[model samples]
Target: MAGKSGRRSENRFIRYLILFTWALFCLMPILWFLSIGLRPRIEIITPQPIYWPSFSLDAWKMIWQDWPMAKYLFNSVAAIFGSVLIDLVLAIPAAYALSRFTFRGRDDIAFYILSTRMMAPAIVAIPIFFLFRNLGLLDTIYALMLVYAAINLSIVTWIIRSYMLDIPKELEDAARTDGAGDLRILWEIIIPAVLPGIITAAVIAMIFAINEFLFTLLIASTPNAYTMSVALANFTGGSDGVIYNAIALVSFIAMVPVFIVVLAIQKHLSRGLTMGAVKG
Candidate 1:
């Protein structure tokens, strides 16, 4: 009995140590970015490698001074929020029909929509660029917003459809028997039940929109419509070459909103992701 108990204790300690080390491995880059962002640019490139150099705010100050950080931030915010709005508006009706109603070729339609995501973004980029240019919307915020919405709508539909399937059909039938219309039932019964899933979908869409680089860089004509990701890449390029400390600072600031949003909606996110694992 003593030998068995001793072995179990050692095993538990080893498991915890392994988990902690993995977490540290993931977080070390983020910590290094923060460290560099607070250090002077000269110390960052020191031959001896100054790990604990004296802290300074020079990098962050230079980043704000050299670029229109506020304009880029505003454009990114508009694109993400606008994309989420369009997605949610369209997804509700599409998911409802897919889950609750019987229609001709419904399954085929759903599969076709999902398959769009399988196509490589690179393949569509050139055509989309030409189309946007012809429409005279190049470098426009609305154009990027619409493109982001279309790109992310497939995942949103899939998620909401899964949640909608879990809602009881009897509830909708009960409302209909009481003379309730389709819109009334959808607003009162179906929507409330699937609110958690909707919130999760919106957050995921927002994150993808904010992180999108290739489309924004290709489609946007000027810095006025640029996103933070493009700005970060530009900071490290051109005749001036890379500025490691400034890049670190911008990267850190760019990541803060995503981190806060994920933390804020953690419970809803967990529920949405684990909706079908066990019978609810």
Candidate 2:
């Protein structure tokens, strides 16, 4: 009994140590960026680096004033929300159809939808760019939103379908026996049941839309439509050299929305992912 107890304690200690190490690995860069962003440019560039620098908001002010920070932020928010909305609207019905109904070529069609994700963005960017240009969607938030929605639709549908499949069909059958139409059953029963999965899908779709740089860079050429990612990249100086502190400040600002979203939906996210995995 004593030997078993000792081994359990050792395992607990090892587990905690591993978790702590992984946490540090993830947080180290964030801490470094926060430290740099808080300090002035001189302190950041000094040969003897100051581990803890005096907090200053000058970089934040400078970047806000010099860059179209507000516009970029607004554009990012608009695009992300728009894309997530579109993804959910389109994915939910498709997922439900795929999950509940039996139709010819259903599996093949589902596979084809998922297979679109296998193509790299770069491979399709030029053709998409020319198509958008021809359609006069270049340098528009709508264009970015549309592209992001299309890019994320496949994965979101698959995830929601998995969760939908986990829900017992008996529930739907009961609703049907009671004279609830298919739309009514979906709206009243299945939707609430799979709400967590939908939240998870929306959060993931938002994250992808927010971080997507390549498509945004290609689609949005002007400051009006450029997102935070593209705006951050624009900070790459030509002759003045990279502004480390400024870059860090803007990067931190860009991360704030995503951090808030993840924190808010973290519970639903875990439950949704677990349910989806177990059910499928």
Task: Compose the digit string of candidate 1's lDDT tens values, residues 1-280.
Answer: 9999999999999999999999999999999999988998888777896656898998888888888887887888888889989999999889998999998999999898899989999999999999999998999888889899999999899888888998889999999999999999989899888988898889889888888999999888788788788888877788877889889988888887778778998888888777755546
What are the per-model C-alpha RMSD values against the true structure?
2.9, 2.8
Summarize candidate 2's per-residue lDDT along 134-228 as a digit string, tens digits.
Answer: 99999999999999999999999998888898899899999999999989998999999999999998988988888899999999989979999
Cα displacement (angstroms), candidate 1, residue 107, comes to 0.3
TM-score of 1: 0.89
For TM-score, the strongest prediction is: 2
Cα lDDT, model 2, residue 110: 92
**Which window of ten consecutive residues has the lowest lDDT sum in model 2?**
271-280
Error of 1 at 74 (Å): 1.2
Candidate 2's TM-score? 0.90
TM-score of each: 0.89, 0.90
Give the Cα lDDT of each candidate: 0.88, 0.90
Q: What is candidate 2's local distance difference test score?
A: 0.90
Query: What's the true lDDT of residue 116 in model 1?
Result: 91
